[model samples]
Target chain A: MIRPANIPRLLLTPAILTTVVTLGVCLVVLLVLSFGRQNYLDIELGLSAHNFELALTKPLILKLMGKSALIATGVTALSLILAYPIAYLIAFDIHKNKLLWLILFTLPCWISYLLRILSWKLILGYQGVVNSSLMGLGLVDQPIDALLYNSNSVVIALTHAWAPFAILPIYVSLEKIDRALMKASGDLGDPPYRTFLRVVLPLSLPGVSAAFVLIFIPTFGDYVTPHLLGGPTGFMVGNFIAMQFGASNNWPLGAAVALVSMLTATLLVCLFIAGSKRAVRAIG
Target chain B: MKNGLERWLVEELECGRIDRRRLLKMMGAAGVGMAATTWSASALAENNLTILSWSGYDIPEMAPAYFDAHPAPDFTLMGSDEEGFQKVHAGFRPDLGHHTSFIVGKYRDAGLLKPIDRSRLTHIDDFFPELEQIVTTDGKLWEAPLSWGNSSVIYRRDQVEVTDSSWGLLWDERYKGRIASRDSLEGLLIVGGLYTGAADPWEMTDAELEKAKDALIAQKPLLRFYWSSQTDLEQAFANGEIVAAYGWNASVAMLRKQGIDMALMKCKEGIVTWTDGLVMMSGGSASDDLAYEFINAYMSPEVGAFLINSYGYGSGNAKAYESVTDDRLAELGITDPDVVISTSKFQREISAETRQRYQAVFDEVKLS
Candidate 1:
């Protein structure tokens, strides 16, 4: 097996080269398009960052970015809180038919994304199941309104959508922990709880960090769930950035805002990477 | 392992040779993929008029009836106005589009739409003169009116007190927990402006916008929920959880038929109504004849009835109302939509800066 390391590298070269070329082409195109003036009447090439300057001043764009950041942070924190315990159980307690538990966790994610979000609309609408159930139970004299729209609805919808993303990474990271470490801790003076707090918790930071990054990026860019659930007030940064490219017809600003969002996401990823680096060093 | 000479050559290439080979294959495969996609896409894109519309615009139930009728245009519901236009710009062309009255000029300026022939539309004359005036730009018709409805306070009379002046009631703290609003930027701002006595709601400057924003943001704690869907909003009203909110006539009419005590009235400073119209797409592969046929199909009274019944909206086809049973017509808000529609004004298309201020101020209002 150790005969030659280049053997695997040689075999993987075609796939690796293909991916690099494909990504290279996309980045080159984005670079070219970034400078072109958007004349809906005609497409052409040019040099410009006038789009960037004007885009920054738009109030709506700024507001949306704020919303996006807020929503992403909230969704990540909420998802981690919900997914952590489930992931911990699967990684430690469930040994037999573990694959079945993985499938069960993943099954809901396999269902249509839009379908799941829209289901909340039905459940929370004026004639929704929640209100109907409440009425049937005679909890109130009249139907309590204001249950669906605004920030509350947005959080509930995003948290539901983000759970699977938060769970899988954590489970993987925890699963990869050495079994001997836990057994050794048990053989030594420490009990199961202390071993988990001291070993399992510290070791699983990489997965938790990975989970946050995964949930954060998509939710930050997600405008649909917030729009349908958040209504106008709950509109996020993604929705705002979308408008610049959309009805607003201000592409430079869209790009700038997109870049800003990208930078924010990059920042988060870098922080996670640095944190993981530190975690690894500390663990060693 | 096969051959030492071949292995030496393979390593000598440093994969640049393979890189070139894959490049050629990818280019060829990509070309083939494009050709295959076009082969299939052309088949799919043909007769497939990717319609830019509202969520309920293309009811799946009516696809068969549409395909049977003077067929061509396929209506695809869009999530929002901004998203629909983005798709149109992004190579997904539609034969025609539906938009609020405000943006028709902007579409024309962007060269995204074609000027329409008023004569070809059978219902052009049937349209309220006020609406007709709005659709015309410097004597050239851009969009044909599709539907127009007034925004009114929709409350179930069974659960809440009905009033002639409803604008004050939306702000009335008595019904605080039970009340709801449409949760629109411009629409909610309009309410806030009126509440503060703005002469024209849309004309608010920055300071005024902030004022309106503050008013709306303050009202948030009072609302059960702000909503976007007419169907869902009606469902809310039907269940009596939503004592009232900004509702179009058609939805209120439909709710009334369900024996819900729904009523619509002109609140002080009066009601704001919108006119939705059809814009023909320009420079698409669509033949002139196909476009004309599609327009004619929409002109049909039968299709008009379908829109009115299911959507709770009106069509411009003058005779479309005749297809509705007299009882149904009166029940569905089409009997004389002209009255409310005739009095209301169209939403004006503003510049991007103004819109930003509008949205910012609108955002500020809801946050307040």
Candidate 2:
């Protein structure tokens, strides 16, 4: 009864089942819930689009969405800029103990994410490490209150929290680059900077795009960092979504906000990938 | 007072109901604990009693008589009454649970509670009559009042200059960037209503709601941050990061204990009062006798004294005041329960629709 042709299909059964059960089922539930309405502590199941209408049209929600996108864009750009150099060093410059260096570079990822974010609070608080050191050095007469509890702090904390994610993909892509291409560019009388611009950077666009999608998607929906560090002006769309479920006690509205946010992120990420692919083709 | 959100998140993570990877992926999704214990045939037959309560009240000190008589009941700590209601609504049955006064009506309407049998409670007459009246609806006692307190401005006396003790201190132009307010909808909106002189802070009309929203928007720039954690507020006070904040009695007591010159202002525009207590859950598998014994023990003066002394909350039992000294009672800001009750404005229950509107207004102010 067991044929070789059926072996591959049987082997794929668990993965397909897992995806359907875990991701597909939950998404369907979320979509259904978004169409429902809240009746006190209970949700009245219906096929109404009232929640979606409100989520899309509310000015407050729109403002928060714009703010979240801005913050996420900042975090992504910062992460790529900070990650690329270190990734480059590990991929091209370092030859001995490269694995050890990679491990050392990503060691911060071993800590709990909550602890890592909290540590940033201690470093950036009013009387934090930076301020205390500056005051001790007689750099200023008063502590710099601007260092914490702002949009910049949120960006800083998110950039640090997501650095390893950006670095690993970039490292892999950089490592995969054929060294012969760079040598060929140099043999054609191109300078080192020109060779890097022509041969190395274009090849790394795949990893750059991967890192962009990875960082932007999560940071766009991040409420914890903004809640902890983003003072009043730093509140994001994620916080608004969370309020619906908590103090607002409107799960359907929360679900609508979440779905809307997800769809927007998906569209933006698709556009980014397409744009980057075209650029890579043009450069090649 | 409700526990901070961070503690709730940590509890969810520890319970294996939520994993860290999923938490990061969701990017701050509210944790709803849906993993109720699956009782085996033998486990169900044993019929263990489960009590859901606030984090600190789950301890044996709160109900010594019941704990001494029975084997320790299964305890689950709630971060907020909403979360507890959600758990029970999702079918996580517990024999008894704690809830605040404002939510009792919702619980009653949802058919999640059973009216108390007043005759079975030995300490029924010892409770403050006013509090008893608060917990009663339609001639039936729905919850046993456990503790009561006020939410008002707690300021560092030495650091700030105050000409008058009023809610206006929160919006004072002089203390801009040195003030913090609560991050909750009810907490901020009620304060906004009181400051704007709304006829009824809880039942504000559309015009009153907009006034409150405008007042809150004007005050937003003055706030250092909207604090959700008592510990964080206290730390900020200690470090002189904030001179004044909207806070609870426990924060005042803790900061004073740390030798900070902290003072709980007697607001000219009445303080926000709240009471929380124990409620028996309907369809609880535990025996009626055990549930009655647990409620009776919590209502006893011994437990009440412990609650007042340790947590800086006013006990529901008037007789519990006899055990505490006049000085300690004064320090806790409840020297006379009758006077405090007469002077303060109790938080009233709002319908779901009204609450949604209030939340919308609050969100608009925060976003603006």
What is the i-RMS of every prediction? 5.2, 2.2
TM-score of chain A of 2: 0.93
* lDDT value, candidate 2, whole model: 0.83
Clashes of each: 15, 0
DockQ (C-alpha) of model 1?
0.24
Candidate 2 structure quality by residue, lDDT tens digits, B305-332: 9988887888888899999999998777
The best candidate in terms of DockQ: 2
Q: Which stretches of candidate 1 lie over 4 Å from their true place?
A: A1-95, A119-161, A164-180, A183-188, A231-233, A269-284, B1-69, B79-83, B118-128, B162-164, B177-196, B202-210, B223-226, B293-342, B346-368
lDDT of 1 by residue, A1-284 (tens): 54586889888889989987897675566556556666543445678865555446656566666667777888888999999999999998998998788778777688787998888878876667888899999886555446676777888888887787778899999999998998898898787787877778778888988888888888888888876777546777776666555555555545656766777777876776687667666654
